[model samples]
Every structure is written in structure tokens, then in C-alpha cells.
Target chain A: MVKFFHHALKFRKDVCIGCSHCMNECPTQAIRIHGGKAELTDNRCIDCGKCYMVCPVGAIIVEADDLSRIFDYTHRVALIPNILLGQFPEGVSISQICSVLMEAGFTHIFEVEHGTRVLEDAMTKMMEEKELPRPLISTFCPAIVRLIQVRFPMFTDNLMLLKAPLDIAAMYYRRKLEEEGISPEDTGVFYITPCAAKIAAIKSPVGEESSPITGVINMDFIYNKIYTKVKQGLSGKGSCCLPAMQPLQPEEMVWSLTEGEAARMPGRTLAIDEVSNVIEFLEKMENEEISDIDFLELRACDQSCAGGILTSGNRFFTVERLRKRAEEAARGNDSMIYDTAGDSIRDHFDYLNEHLKVTQIKPRAMDKLDEDMEQAMLKMRKVQEIMKDLPYVDCGICGSPTCNSLAEDIVQGKAHVNQCIYVQKRWEQEGKLQPKESMEILKEIWGEDKF
Target chain B: MAERMQFEYNVDGGNFTRAGFASSEIKKILKKLNVDIGIVKRTVVATYEGEVNIVAHAYSGTIYVDIDTERIRINLKDEGPGIPDIDQAMEEGYSTASSQVREMGFGAGMGLPNMKKNADEMHITSEVDKGTEVEIVMFLNNKE
Candidate 1:
């Protein structure tokens, strides 16, 4: 058995309506509808949020850090995602945003966008002599990365080895705090994030572990406070260009947009907008048809971080204005973004890639999958034999997706074979397909069942 | 026609809400059978894509799923006016989806190509006057 460091699918049983929504949406089939409840199979799920996205009644929620958990620590740092900057209303300066975090019980606050500067420098150096895959995929979307592990394992190498904005920011903050003589044991770093995916990533990171950050504060909860402070101009004056904590290079600032990753790297690149669109593009890449593209910038949300579900601004106008701001800011700067102090700083901490130890156990052989392969085969054969005697109209008025899906459901004990619209049509056509016993079964399973 | 496993689905062409019901159910059946995850996914994608295309584009159609120990197959047959050119239809950036379909966040022009890419073998035959038929086969253990 492989030792997985993450928790299994966490279901809020109260919210779950037993609609089989998660079971239907899950790509790995890790979930099943049993006894009118969604049951998850241990060790099968890849932690992709497909089920999380598709639940109708908000039944499923991923395991996330409650910021209240970090209250036990003496000192805490809030590493805020840059997207949170736009979540406030007009006149909110970066200073006011930082101040609200300080006001909301954080000892210190750092912009994660600044962390992108350090990461860009490190990544550029790493890619200098590399023969990386054409159309190298962005590792930024944790949900997308998990999707790759389950559905597109062949494309894993296309991901950049560099850590994401939160991790890199956490690293920069921890180092700065440690240099000031703060002990790692006493300091806790929490990511103020825009989505549930980041919380999942922090708790069970894909590539690395012992994350620089300790937990997350829901951006939804803190948005109003930060906005109110920024609106009231409560914070002291400070240049957005030069913060007192540290200076970020122009290249790092550009990473706020969609293709920002490829813009910083030297190569052919493609930036795909929207999570749903990336799914189709990845399929093309898998087929070896989109070989012309060299690097891919895949943003889960449309308009990059600007369109995160937690952001308060209108995405189109904000993205346009932010782009203009970034271009103007970058015009005069030509300095290298990394620090020489980072060398001694990198050595003091113990860094480990948490996912290095992750391994998947092989599934049992097909014959051994169920002791009743013969029984299943009998059920299938019966389904087919019944299909030959029935009408073929597949209309899902029967509640399944198609006639075939219904027949399979019937075999699997989810539905009765007589639900096919054609079967009813055949009974009407021949005046005999619906004998009483099967009608009773259909009525028993599907209330108000009319065949 | 080649020997097909022969299953049918009644697509609610008028209801956008019931669109992927068939695909979801097929996914479940494949899972219970201990089908290869890759094959199960490919079948589901092709099945849903075809089913959606029929419901949204063609007036309506029946989606068929055929599976054996050796391979899994999907055939989506619609009784609507057929494609003008099958080759042009196979292009990655081509789409015939409606505005209503696009609002649902689909119609990327990648559906047909994605289905083809995922399946190891595919055969499509259609006539302008009659209905169109698409057959896709993904072998259980074969490398593409």
C-alpha cells in the first residue's frame, strides 16, 4: 500500500442530497451512490475538483485549513495573493490592503506577487540549459495539475519545477522573518487566497511539502475589511513600486496577467484562458497534434488571477486597467530580479519535495476486480437479450443520460431495463412488452414510474 | 455494420439541464465493470460530446455504447441533416454549435478532434439526405 499524505474526499453529509452528483461528475469513479449517499473509494481519487465543481447543492467541499487553527501560534504572517488587490473598491492602495491584514490580527503582511519575482529569477536560471518539453504546461493551477496526474500523466514533465506564487511567497516571508531571528517553530505563515484549490494545494502540495506557509484565510471573509480600510485611506503613505519590506523587479510585476509565465521565459509559448478551455487544449496536446507550440500558459480562471471566484472587481475592466499599469511600471526598469543574500538564506532551512514519496498502487486485474465477473457478464447478456426484444428510442425521459447508459444502469442495479422509451414504445407497438412483474420493479425504483 | 454492443439513450434535446445524464451513467457503468480508467474517460467524453452535439445541433439522436473485454466503443447517430464535408468537420478550430450552446461554456471546436484523439480507432459515415453515424473504438490495452 502506498502511503498518501492527503485526506480522502470530505463530504458535508448535511449538504449532500444523495443526488449522485459527485458520483456522476467524478472522472476517476472514486465515488459511488450507495444507500442514497455518495460513498468514496479509498486510494482511487486523484483529488481533482471535478466533483467539487459539479455538485448542485454544494454537497462536497475539499479539506481546507481554518485560519482559526493558526491562532495557537505566537507570530503569524499573512501572504496575500495579488488577485486580492482588485477585490476591493476604488481608492484602495496596496498599503491600505496590507494594513487591513495587520489589523485583522496578522503581525506582518507580504504581497505574493513579489514572491513571483524571486521565482522568475530561479526559473529563468533553471531553464537556461534545459531541453524542456514543447508547450511546457504551467504548474500554477493545482486543480489542473491533479487532473493531469489522473487523466494526462504523460504531460506531467511539461510542468515547471518551480513552486507557485503562494509557496514562493511563503519562502520569501519565512526567510525574511528568520533573518530577523524569529524561530520557525514560533512563526506561522498563512496564505490569504482567492479559491478553494489553493487551500487544497497547501494542505497536500503536489511537488513539494513542508510548505513555507502554514494555513489559509478565506478571501471571502476578509474582503470587506480590506476594502473598507483602503476606501477610508486609513493606511500610511507608501509607494506601490517600493515597499518597506523589499523591492520587486518589473518582470515579477508582469506575472499578474494570463501569459505572464511565458513572457518571462525565453521560448515559443501559448497562453490558454479558462479552465474548461484548457481541458480541450490538453487533449490536442496529448494527441501529438499541437506540436508547434513550445510553452503553454494555462490559467484555470479566465483573465488570469483577475477572474478568480473570490475577486470583487468586474474582470474585464480590471484586467485591462491592470495590464496598462504593469506596462507603464516596467518601461524604465532593467535590473536583475534576484538577490545575492538568497544564497545563504536558502541553506538555513530544510526543504523537501513532499510529493516525491507519493506513489500509486496498481489496481487488481480485471478478472479479480469482482468475484462476480460471471454474474456481471450474465447481467450484461440479459440486458442485451432484452434490448433485442425492446424498442430502441433512447430518450432520457427515463432519467438516465441515454438508452445505453440506462441499460448499463439497469445491470448495475441503478435502474430497471424497462425504462427505455423505446421499450415502452415497443410495448405499445406490440401490445405486450410491459408484463406486470417488470413494471412493478420499475415503479419500485423510480417513483411514479410509467413505462 | 460491424458487430456493436448496441445501447441507446433518449436525449432530451429541449432540456439543457438533462444534457450530460447519459455520459454520467455510462461513466458509472464503466467504473463498476473495472474498465480501464483511460478507456472509461475516453468513452464518456466521446459519448457526452456526441450526445450534446445531437441534442444541441442535430434535432436529436441516440448514443450507443459497445464494450467487450478487448475494447470499448461509442456510436452517436442523429436523424438530422448530415454534415457537408466530414474532413472539414474534423478540423480542430471548426464548430457548428449554437449561441445557446456557447453560453453553456462549450463549443471550443475541439470536441470532434478530442474524441478522435482519445479513441484508438474511429469510423464515421454519413449521407446528406439521411442521418449521420459516428463510431469510435478504444482498445483496452493498446498503445496509441
Candidate 2:
């Protein structure tokens, strides 16, 4: 039985050209070319959105809730990350963005990073505990958390089982609304996400039973809507529904950038970004080659959330804009720009802290060939035996990501050993397989139209 | 009875950059075979320390890995100036490593002790002038 992992990335077979770009670039080798399309292994995909970035035909779509979903509740709140503010040009003020969100049918707006302030204190407390594992890994990036679960299962214990800023913020905001006499069903909290992994996390959270967030709108979609409104000089200034935007603290403003959490932690910490870099570092860490670190801030994207696949701005520019905003907040220059939103989250710190923890995240190891030890060992030998004839070129012509993966697939009964072009050539020369039969195999793997 | 899988990886002496290669390959194999994660962790730690010992102290070495349903057994054989005082070498802080090797973080004299701590069964054999051989076995069923 195959376990189903909810992925926000959806592949449209009609638009995929089977060019194999996504298969080649996937960090986990989760994609395989089949029937002239890219097929995703549900358990293997971490929903990092790397394939979405590399697709030439825009076939890979990040699933998002329809904007109309916000109208379902009486009190609609837009929970947005700080990186969303960095998407706009310097000319567009934060006030203008809030007004546009209000114009887009949201009754309230809240920054996700506000939850980090609450998390920072809890993290420091966690670091002070002598009994926990060394080098506690942050659970900020959903993609990195899922990556660790599927690829490096041993490190799952090292993950700090705390809610991410988005979750904390959502919980805080929902509680605030509840205190204001709004029923839970009447309040809808929609997160404007910068990546598919965030959507997946919201839909099928790893440790927690379910997310407090009611829906997710992709950052790119909201960015386009706000940018278009801003450009047309249609941002409703002084609208009656304008939210009293709270000025985020400097540290909170830059919490999603690289080294954001690591710099705030108590002890020696290292921040590594980009999926491939994280994988390399983790492999060494798993081998016990690296040790004695206090905390690890691992982000799937290069510049952290600024480099999210759904982000519209240039990653470097987004980082620069966010850093500038942080500096301005540090200087107290933004205090005059917006009014106080409401009671500070610190006022409810104790209540929020009580709900801050997530249950232990179970490791769903994708590398295991079988559940039974004996069967897995037998499959291992069969994969090795099949690998003997492979060219080891990792051409992806066999539809699997690498020659080794093809062998594993063959042993698992998902693929045939003859799918290898090298094996087909050898067999043809040996007069064992006819050329027409080999061509038929290619058609079966690649599709009839491909020929 | 399950069929056993055998693998051998060569480790070049003094190659710090490639010290974890054999252990990493073996780790991948154990993971694919659905071995208990605790067993995998201990096995890799022991293999890594042993591999690094060969790199920091030996001329050359080969790691022979044998895996069955019950347990994983690894033997590391290397040609080098072997341990004259095996008891002292197994001490936590005792060091025969050169100053250069210490600077590279390879030799803290914790190699043999770390292997012994992680492995369920460990054995050492050495000749004063010829070589050293270390064998470690970790059971798949019972975990520490």
C-alpha cells in the first residue's frame, strides 16, 4: 500500500513536454518521465516547488484556494508573510498594500512574522534545556521539514517540535477574534503563501492535526492583484475598512531571511539555505562527520523565503528591500506610517505559549525498499543485481531519474530492466531483442506521439 | 534465512576529504534495507570513526561490509605503523596522532573508543610494524 502525501504542486500532463528538466533538477529524484509526462512519487515529493521553477511550459501549478473563498465567513483575515511586502517597488507603501488587501475583500490583515517574536523566547528556553538533542533544527521551512522526514529520517528527532510563525500568528489572530465575540466558524483566516510547501503544510501539517489557517492564496496571485491595483492608481486611500497595520519589530521583519532564526538563537548556530546545500550538509551530519552545533536553520530556498518559487520579485532585490525595511524598523522610522493594530501579542504570550508546541513528527522514510527487513534485504540484492547491466550514466532515458533509481524501480516491479537503452543496444547486438520490439518499449515509456 | 549482501570500499590514507565515503555508502545500503534507524546511526558512527582512523594513521585500507537479516558486520583492514600499546590507544584522550592531523580535527584519540561505544561487538588486532584490523558488528534486532 502506497502512503499518500498531500502535495500542493499539481502536474498537468497535457502541458508537460516530457523534456525531463524537472526530473533532472529534482533534489529528491521524486519525478520520473512516463507516457511523455512527468509523474510525481507522492511519498518522495517534499513540495519544494523546484520543479515548478524549472518547468518551461508552466505546466506545474501550485494549488491555491480561490479568492472567493474568503467571502464564506463574516470576518476574513489575510495572514501574510513579511516577504510579501518586499515584493512591491519602494514607491508602493505598506499602507497601500494593506488597503489593496482590504479592497480584495479581507476585513483584517496580519503579518506572519509577528509570531516569531513569541517563538524567539520559546526557542531560547528550548536551547537552555540540557537534555534535548544538540543542534536543534528549526521547523520554519515546511519543505526542509518534509525533506528531513523522507530523506534523512534519523534527524527527525532533532527537529524542534514547535509551530512555525505562520501557525502561531494564525492561532494568535484567531484567538484575538474569538475574544472579540466572533465565532470560530464565522472567522476565516487565509494565508498568502510564498511557496507550495506552505500550502501543503497548511493542508496536511506534519506534526499537528490540522492548521488554524482556513485557506491559502499563492503569493504570486495576490502580488499580481495588488500590483495591478497599485499601478492603476486605484488603491482605496483612507478606506473605511483600512486595517490599523502594526509596525513589526526589526528582528521579526527579517525572520524569514537566511540566518534569521539562527542569529536569534542562544548558542552556536549555523544557517544553511538551498535544498542541495542542505542535503549535502545533512548527509555529512548523518554520517556523524559534523558535530557540536547548537542549532541549525535550514531553508529550502536559496535566500530563504525571498527565493520562494511563487515570489514575483528578484530574490536579491527582495532580500535587499527586506533588509532595508528591517533597518528602518530598527531606527523607529516606520512608527509614524501606521496606527497601532491592537493589543500586542505579548499581552497574550502565556496563552499562545501554551499552544506553541506541536506533537512529535513521525519519520516517513521513503528510502526503505520494503517494510519487512527480510523482504527489503532481498529487494536490495535484486536492485544490485539489476544495476550490474546498467550504464550508470543517469541519462533519464529509462524514465527514472538515475540508473540506480531505475534498477530500484525494476526490482520493486514498477519498471523493466530492458528500459535501459544500454541494455537494449546490448541485447540487439546479441540478437536477443529485435529493433522493432525495442522501439515499442520506447514508445511505451515515452508515449506514441513522442516517436 | 535471507541472502547476505557484501560490499567493499577502498579508503586512501591521509585523504581527509574522502574519509566518510565508505560509511556514507554503507549508511545508504542499511537505510534502503529498512534497518532500524538506531542501528543505522550506531553502525555509521562506528564505521566513520574507523574510516577516519585509517585515514589519519594508516597507509591504505579497505572496508568490507556484510549485511544479513540479523546483523551488520564491518571489518576495516589497513596497512600502517600499527598500535604498539593497544590499551593506551583505546584510552579516551591518549593521542599518537601528529600535530598536523589534530589541526585537521581528525585525531582526538577518540577513534577506537567511539567505535567500541557504538558497536555491539568490537575486536582489534594489530602488529607492531605491519598493520591493524578492526571489526565491528551491530545487531539489527536489539538496539542500545
Candidate 3:
């Protein structure tokens, strides 16, 4: 079965230092090093971009758009995320930075604030209805969605079916441009993104929309260009000169932070971050231990998307900036802002279908014992028995990540007992290395090193 | 009823934080077997709920899991205060958990219902003051 979904992140082997940093640090344990090179298991990788952050030599990269297509669109909408608002230097608003984009050739800038308000209103109604299962897991994070697919498919029903705010923003404009007599194909929406997962989301969205976004431009990929423009006196706009640009309210801006959506949920809720901690909580939820939880907002980054690997600023610094700006914007009159007026913002999301559902996917099976259950039991016993004969220390010297893994690999027919250096040296010292099985092991173990 | 292999776990009821460890381990084993995803999901959900009940409501328990060619069966037996009314226990939102447990966001009386909904076959037997035993079975090859 085709296991892993499409992932945009790439691992460049030539640049990899193979320090085992990505291998040991992977939350899902998707990466392993063999022959001094790193390999990512598609089945185990959730595309959370964890390895990208941990790679010291910058071997991991998400394919980036050069922004060369911006001029191709007759009407361009630069969809600046709220996270980007936190990236600029102090005293410079995002509109000022966006003005730099306009100077770079963007026709217009549409802040993704309207979609945030629509999500708030729609989710509030869903919360009030209380129709779905308790603890509705937020579907906003693409990495979290993939996490469920590959690790916790049982909770598939719990994922909120609403399209992500990015999709909503893209669809919202594609139609608005069409309504204004501009061809839908003529209007291009480019997302200045925070992570590679978002870029993957644009290419293969969970919802049914085929290519909701026209293109995606990575945050750090264009940071220097925009920063240089700001340095070149293209910024410092006093008023909102960008067309269709709306000030983001505090509630909408908080969505970029961890637990931002769950805070709006008044009942028992949880907002979790960091891929490892997120897995811990998800295991409890899967066990039905935390049924009282009404909502869960989970992010793959340590502190939310501000902590994403694609961002320019440090997480703590940028989160502070984002929160401060959002607080100031919340005190204003942004269109479709969340307030006590209790009005429906469904009209804002009219470009999207009334009901959008994420395509259900399943996890890959990596450690199957055998095709036959009866044979599988026999294999299990053999593995356990072989484990006793080998050293217990979990050293990853034989290309396998651990001693236990090497034993399993032996049983899986991927490796042999002699691949272990300790086993080979012990046999050689004891003068028992003449056995045919031990000789075969001797050839492969040292084939790359000594043989 | 003969099984190819049976696994056992001793659940420590004292630590509510470590309640899902056994269930997580079981899910890994099942995944390694290349079991059907639907069956694996149900098995994880149902038995996980069973495992948590031992931690939350009972004193201590032992979970016995038997993996067969066509099915997976788990029986969780606890040695603590048992339910006086099994039917009422199955109802949603009827929990006898202490306020402390409730404060931690558990004990909404949804655990048993979640177990029943996920398992292909579920059987619960309880004796007042003796203990409660939950048996959940999920078929691996049942296409329907």
C-alpha cells in the first residue's frame, strides 16, 4: 500500500553531516542513518518538519517558490499570515512590509484576517451545537492532521472537518476576484508561509478543493528580499495603503499562538505543542481517559507556528511580538472581528463549500511479524530468543538504530547476526569465526570499513 | 479460544498520568503485525478505555491480551470497589469519579460508552465491592 502522503520537505544527502541528530531527535522516529547517510521512512514521517529544525548542516529544505510567478498574475493577493506580522523589526507594521512586497511587484495584499473571524464564528456555533464527539481536535495544523493519519487513525472522526484558514483565505479571494469580473484563473493567491507542511498543504490539501492556493512563498525564503526593501526606504507607510488589507483583531491573531483556538473554547479544553508532548496527550485521548475535554488545539512547533523552522525570528521573541501587535489590533475596528455583537461571519467564508471534509488516510504497518499469524508467532519467539544471545546495550553501530532493532532486522531478513561488531569480535577471539554463517556475517560487517 | 500468544500488563492505579502506557505499547505491537487499520484503531480505542478505567475507578488491575489469527481479545480485571449498577455505569455522563479526578478532566462516564462503541464485542461483569472485569474483542478479518 502507498503509505505516506506527499511531503514537500527534502533531505539532501550530500549536505548531511550524519551526526544522528535527526535520527535520535525525530519524534515519530522516522529518520535513521545507514552508511553515514540519513534516511527518512515515509511511513513513519508525519512531515512535522522536526528534522528540518534539528539538522545542524542545513541538509533539510522545503522546496521554495522564487516569487518569480508574482508578475504572471494580473491581480495578485499577498496573503500575509499573522505569524509574519511578528517577524518584522519593532516599529514596522506588516502593511509596511507588505508595501515592500507591492514594490517587489505584488498587485495587492489581503491579510488572512477575514478567514480567522469566519472560523471563530463557525467553530463557536459547532461548540454550541455539541453534536460531534467530545474534544473536537482542531484541524488547522497540517502536521497534526498527518500525525493522526499515520499514528492515530482511530481518532479520525474527531478531526474538525472545516477547511484550514489558509484554504478558506485562498478560496475566499479566488471567488471575490471572479465576482469582480476578473477571471478566477487571473487572480493568484500566494501564501507567505511559516512551515513546509503548509506548502505541502497547498499542493495536496486535505479538503476536496483542487489547488485552493495558487502558490506558496516560504517566510525565510523571501525574508531577506523584503528586509532589504525595508532597508532601502520602501517601508514606513502611515496609513493602510495596501488594497483589501484588514487589521487583524486580537482573537484572530492569537490563532497563530499555541492554544489560541482552544482559549476561545470556554469548556474543558487543551492546547498542546511540541511534537513529542503532543503525542503523549494524544495517546491519553485515544485511551478515552480525557473525555471531558470539549476541544483540543494542537500545534507541531514547540510554541506554535511562530516556532516553525521556516521563521526568521526566535520563537520566544516573535511570539512576544505577535501577541503585542495582536493586542493592539484587537483594540481596533477590524472588519469581521470577534465581539459581543454575536453576528454570523459565515458570509466571509462563502467562497468555500458549506461542508468540507478532510480525506481519511491510514497509518503504514512497519513491523508486521509475518503474513501468516501462526508464522508470526513463531517469528516472535525466534526474535525474543535471539535477543537473549545478543548484547542488551542499545548501541547503533551496525546501521540499525538500536540493539533491539538489529535483532528485529535479523528476524525480518534485512540483516544477519554477524552485522554486530561485538558478536563478530567475540567469535574471532574465541577462534569460532570459521563457521559458514559467521563468515557470511564477517563479509558484510566490514565490507564498507575493513574488508 | 486457544491463542498463539498472550500478553499481560500490571496496571498501577496510583499514577493517573501513566494510565495509557500499556495501551500505547499494545497499539505498537498490533501495528507491527500489519493488522487491518480499522481493527487496530478499534482495538486501541476500546482496550485503551478499558485500561484507563482500571486506573481511574479501581485499585489495581491486570490486563490479559490474546492475539489470534483472526481476532484480538483483551480482558482487564481489577481488584477494587466494583460498580453496584452496571447499566447506569454505561450511561453517558454518569460518573462516580471523585472531584479530584473530575478536576483533572476525567470521569464524565464516557469511558465505557467509548469502549463499547469501538469494540466489535464487549462484555462487562462487576461484583459490588469485589471488582469489575471488561472484555473487549475486535475481529481482524471481518470485512463488514
Candidate 4:
């Protein structure tokens, strides 16, 4: 049955070494080893590019969106993600990067961080109103949001349901530019995104019917443009459009880290950072271990936005520097931005009602268990009975983690029982069954009688 | 086909390193049974929390798990120091854990509260000098 959305196109099969790097890193068990290849289950994929970022072979590449339409606009604006800050270390300042983008046929550069400020203000109001449910997970990363929608649907209500920082920034930018008499059709706002998930989010947001983003320009490609302009602007003071907003000094940049989202909001909330920690927290929340807390800020990456897989900075140094920078930029109190941004955008930004439409797709009925105590016991006995005859090396050369992981895989219809090494060896030793016969037996045990 | 399955786990309070073993085994068992992910996760968290509580707070105990068509029921009976105030323990961030337990990141005073959160229905009976018994029930329904 065709299931998951056509989001993750960066996954190239030839480059996948079956290292399970993507499997381990993926928030959902979407990518699994099926027939010795990294097979993604359409039902399981949230299109969160955690796998894309961590793949060693660069096997996964997010298909770049066609932003040629943005060139159609008389006034084009590039919204740069904060992680781009890590790319330009030695040569150019952020202002210089902004100057470069203007020279690159763009009219202006609006740092997406500006949207972060709006979100911060909105979150503060959200906290004060206490309108959101306990453990309000962040909705900044579309992949993470989709992860909740698909894998953790029960927790979907627990999510903030608000638009991400980039989208918030886009909303404000569009409205502000329109107010200045700039026609909405003539103004194109493209995000210089870190990952393809953002690009896909802009193209097709799951919760919302439409997205504020016009298009995406990959940060990897645009970093060179920023560099070229940095060199040219330094030599000759190039005439270019000046950005309306400035980088949040040094202290404000700390919002790039893992817990920065929660810290920015003027509220009493818990900010749990890191993917493992986020998983543990979600598991706890699902179990109902944590409640009554007003807000929950979760980022799949380790060190917030600065530590995103798309960035080039050393995670440790970037986090330390970003922390100091955020503190310095904010002038010690992080709430200043929220207090000063006024209430217009802040009030609207935090107002999120999911109103999501989802079809809870259960697996085919033949896969469903009897749920009988006797059947479960009978299955367990058969599993043990099968396990004893098989050697328990768990080499995974048998294509399973162990005789046990294989047993579970077989029972779950993820694998055939004959894949067990012991079963194969028994067929070899007993001479009663051929390899094909052994495979047929496996299929039969797993309820695949058609084999 | 509503069949009943019962399993018993011996939880030892003597060792901290061996904690979560029972829960992990049960997770494997549930996975093999092709139970729903929601049910498996809830059972894992509940059993793990209960097992950890037994080792951390109880003298020694046993967890009885009954799996049926309708629900998964776990009854944890322990001879450990009973809860002094169940009401206070239910609150978030409220804990009786010591500094040593805090060092291991195990005791944030979140154990009982976590258990209560995961289980659909929970009942606790305890005495300070005698022992503690916690019973939890989780329905297998797909909907919340």
C-alpha cells in the first residue's frame, strides 16, 4: 500500500552502505534493512532529514527546490537560517553576507532569526495565557513535527502547533512589506534553509494548507555567494540594499543552542535538548510521567539551531561561543526582545489550533495479533522451540540483530523465520530440506502461505 | 480469541546495575507478539518505572503482568519502605530520592509520578514500616 508523502528524495540507494547510521539517527524507524538495502517504510517516514545530515557517504541529498520563480519578483528577499553563521568564521561578518546576497541579484536579506524574535514574543504570551497543553513540543523543524504526527500521534496534541521561526518571520515580512505598498505578488521571500525538510515544509506543510515561504535556496550552495560578495564588498564598497533587521548582537545568538527556544520565551518551562533526551521525554510524556508543565521545547539536534547538521562549526566551540554571544546580544536579559516587539505579532504567533486531518493507518489485518493469552503463549513457545535448534551467534549476517531480533521480525512480518541462522544450519545438517524448502517453511511460519 | 497470558518477574533491590532488565525482556516479548506500538511503549515505560522503583525504594519485590484482549495489568508488591504520603509523591518534581541517586540521574523524584502517568489506572497501598503495593492497568484500545 502506497503510504508516506513524497518528501525525502535525497535518499540515493547506491550511496547507502547499509551502515544503519540513518536508521540509528532517524527519529522514526522509517529506514530499515530490507533485502540488504536501506528500505524506507512509507508509513513511518516523517521526512525529518536527521538521516540525511548524518550519512557519511553523502548518499542522501535533499533535492533542491526550483526557486527560479523568485527571480520573477521585482523585490526578492533571502531569509537565511541561523546555522549559516557557523559557515563564515574567518573572513566575513553577517552584515557582509547580507551585502553579498543583495549583490547576488537579491534586493534584501532578512535573517530568519528575526522570525525567532517574533516566536519568542509569541511564546511568552502563550506561557502567560497558559493556553497550550502540558509539554508543548516545538514545531520549528517540520521533520520533528511530522515525527510526532506519524510515530507519536497521541503526542501531536502536545506539540506547540505554531508555525516555525522561518514561517513566522515570513508571515511578518510579507505583512510588513505589503504595508509598505509592496505588492504581495511582486515580493518573493525564499529561505536559505539548512536541510531539505525545511524546503519540503515550505512546499507542503502538513498541518497548514499553505506555507508563507516562496522557495528555498540551499545554504551549501549560497555560502560561496556570501563569500564572493564578502571579498568584493571588502575591496570595493558595493552598492546594495540594506536589510531592515540586524543580527541579534552576540547575546541573542545563544538562541541557536539546544535549550535556547525555551530560554527565549518569558515563562517557567522545561527545555529538554538532544534527540535521545527528546525521545526519552516523549516516552515519559506518553507514559504520562510528566505533566502540569506549561511548555516543552524539543529540538532533534543536540545544540539547538547552531548545532544543526547543515552547519560547519565544531559543535562544542559553536555552542560555547553562541551562548556567550546570545548573552551579550540580549544584554543579560533574554526577555527584552519579547517585551519590546509589541503585542501584534506576539499575540497572533502563539495562537495555534492544530486542526490536523490524519488517517490513522493501521497495518493490514492479516498482521494483527489474536490478542489471546493462549495464542501469545503458544507463539512464545514456538519461538523458543525454533530458537533452540538455531545457533545464537546474532552476527546479523543472518540479516537480523540476533536470533531474538529475527524472531520478533518474523512475528511482525518484517522478516521470514527461515532467515534465522540455526534454521538454515539445520536444513544444511539434516539433509531433509533444501535451502528453498527451508525458506518456504519460514514463509509459512510467518503466515505467508502463498510462498 | 481472547486468551490470557501471565508472566512474573523477580525484581532484586540489591543491584542498581541490573535494573530495567525485566522491562527490556518484556518489551522484547511484546514486540514479538506484534502488539501495537502504543501498547508496547506504555507497557515498557510502566514496567521499567515499576521495576526501577522496586530496586530503588523497595526492599525486594515481584511484578505480576497479565496480558489479555482487554488490557495489560501489572501488580507490583514489594516489602520495601512504604510511601509516607502518596499525594505529595504524585506531584511533579516531588521526590524522596537521596543525593547519591540524584548523581546517577535516576532520582529526580520522578519515579512514582512517571508510573502514575503511564498507567491508565493506578492503585497504591503502602505502610511506612511494613511495605508497598502498586497496581496498574493499561487498556489496549487504539484510541486515547
Top DockQ hit = 2
Candidate 2 at B108: error in angstroms?
1.4
Model 1 TM-score is 0.60
Give the alpha carbon lDDT tens digit for every residue of B1-144 in model 2: 567889999999989998999999999998998898878999999999999999998999999999888889999999999999899999998888899999987788888999999999999999977999999999877744
Ranked candidates, highest lDDT first: 2, 3, 4, 1
List, for all models, the DockQ compared with the true complex.
0.06, 0.85, 0.42, 0.25
Tens digit of lDDT per residue, candidate 3, span A189-263? 899998988888778776554766788898986677777767877664633445433445687777879878988
lDDT of 4 by residue, A1-451 (tens): 6544557445677766666567656655555554434666665666656787778888887776555666899979887765776566644555566656766777766656666666565556666665556666667766667666654555665666467767766777777678779999998888887666677767767666677778778776787666665665552255444443444545245555666676666545777655667766765565444556666777666666655555555767766655654665667543112334333443344332121122222222122233554576676766676676557775554455466556655665677655665667766788856877776554443324324
- TM-score-better candidate, 3 vs 4: 3
Error of 1 at A448 (Å): 11
lDDT values for all models: 0.63, 0.91, 0.75, 0.65
- The i-RMS of every model, in angstroms, reads 7.8, 0.9, 2.9, 5.2
> Could you tell me the TM-score of chain B in model 2?
0.97
Model 2 interface DockQ: 0.85
Model 4 chain A TM-score equals 0.76
Model 2 regions more than 4 Å off:
A2-4, A239-246, A340-342
Model 2 superposed RMSD (Cα): 1.5
When only the first chain is scored, the TM-scores of the models are 0.71, 0.97, 0.87, 0.76
Across B48-88, the per-residue lDDT of candidate 1 in tens digits comes to 76766666666677888776666777788888778889898
